[model samples]
Target: MDIHEFLELPHRFRWGGVGGDDCMTFPASWALKCVGVDPAEDLRGTYRTREEAHAIVDNYGGELAFMDSHLAKIGAKRVQHPETGDIGLIKAMTGETAVDQIETQIGAIRFGPLWACIHPGGIRATPAEFVAVWRLTA
Candidate 1:
């Protein structure tokens, strides 16, 4: 799918939503598509809740650590400036948890200055300054 189609993918709270929603899955799925991988075919049934997300991050030490580990897993590297198609580990002032705790989100760069992913109202673009970018290693 092209950027427009990817951006138009339905948003939901499910872990790996083809039509579901969640921060990580939305962009993670998109990143996989950039590499010619289908998330529904490869990444299925994982990180289904806020607690699960926290546990996974705690397992790797913390948010940044988890992001690093994840990036490494996908062969992506941290970048000072993200271009289109780069992944971003975003730290927004807002987060979602069943118990009202904070959380982080992952999104893909759709263009200069914008990181696109599933937000509360649906898929939207956030400022690149709001995230730490990671690009796939060449």
Candidate 2:
């Protein structure tokens, strides 16, 4: 599916699940669609609480490191310019939103000028900018 179709997917974001995963899960889902592989497969459905999620992030020394390690498996390359459907890291360490309970960094997808993230209510546009971006090489 293309980014436009991905945006229309029905969702009720959850702390952990296959399709309804955490904040990063949203963009990670997009990456899966792009590459036909789940970079987060091992950790999905393994956490239920914020604390458990944080523990997983801590295992990798923090969110950035954790994501860097996982995304690498899918041939993710860091890029300065973000394009539509590109996955990115949105810095939330400053406590920008309550959705950031794990590693203080959330995942978002570039859709035009806006970044899209999965909110508890559903998919929503994020005001937070992409501090780092990755393009999947498949």
Candidate 3:
């Protein structure tokens, strides 16, 4: 399915460990699989943070190729459309950049920092708190 179709899926806020925690981790991958993209082939299993995932999707041609191939499977293009939910690549923020300084001051808190924007909702919604939304067209 296209990113728009993927975005249409009901999103449950994911944190971690089968319930909720902080990172979007499995939810994002699951979302992609829900949209018909094979996680084993499309995603790298070693990502420790959303930022790492975003970096891969951005700089790694292999990951982009995976997204492109899957988009074709759903008859969707990678074009940025206003009404579609694009795959959101995110990262964690720490130190003074965190959403809550006090909470992070004691240790390290991971926050969803939007790295990549995907369109539509049916595909998948990562557990990480959504920071922004975008649409893909054409």
Clashing pairs for predicted structure model 1, backbone only: 12-20, 12-21, 13-21
**Clashes in model 2: which pairs?**
none
Query: Across residues 1-138, which tens digit of lDDT does each residue of candidate 2 receive?
Result: 888898887777778756486786777788888899888888889988667877988999987888888899889999999888888888644323667444457888888887887766677775665668889888
Segments in model 3 whose C-alpha atoms lie over 4 Å from true places: 1-34, 49-75, 84-138
Better of 1 and 3 by TM-score: 1
The lDDT for every candidate, in the order shown, is 0.62, 0.79, 0.34
lDDT of 1 by residue, 1-138 (tens): 566777766556565454575666666677676775433333346566667756765877876676566667767778886677777777654455557645455544555567776666676676645447777653
Best by lDDT: 2
Number of backbone collisions per candidate: 3, 0, 30
TM-score for each predicted model, relative to the true structure: 0.72, 0.87, 0.30
Ranking by lDDT: 2, 1, 3
Could you tell me how far off, in angstroms, the CA of residue 69 lies in candidate 3 after the best superposition?
6.4
What digit string (tens of lDDT, one per residue) describes model 3 on residues 20-99?
Answer: 21223332443444454423344434454545644665563543453444445544443332222444323333333345
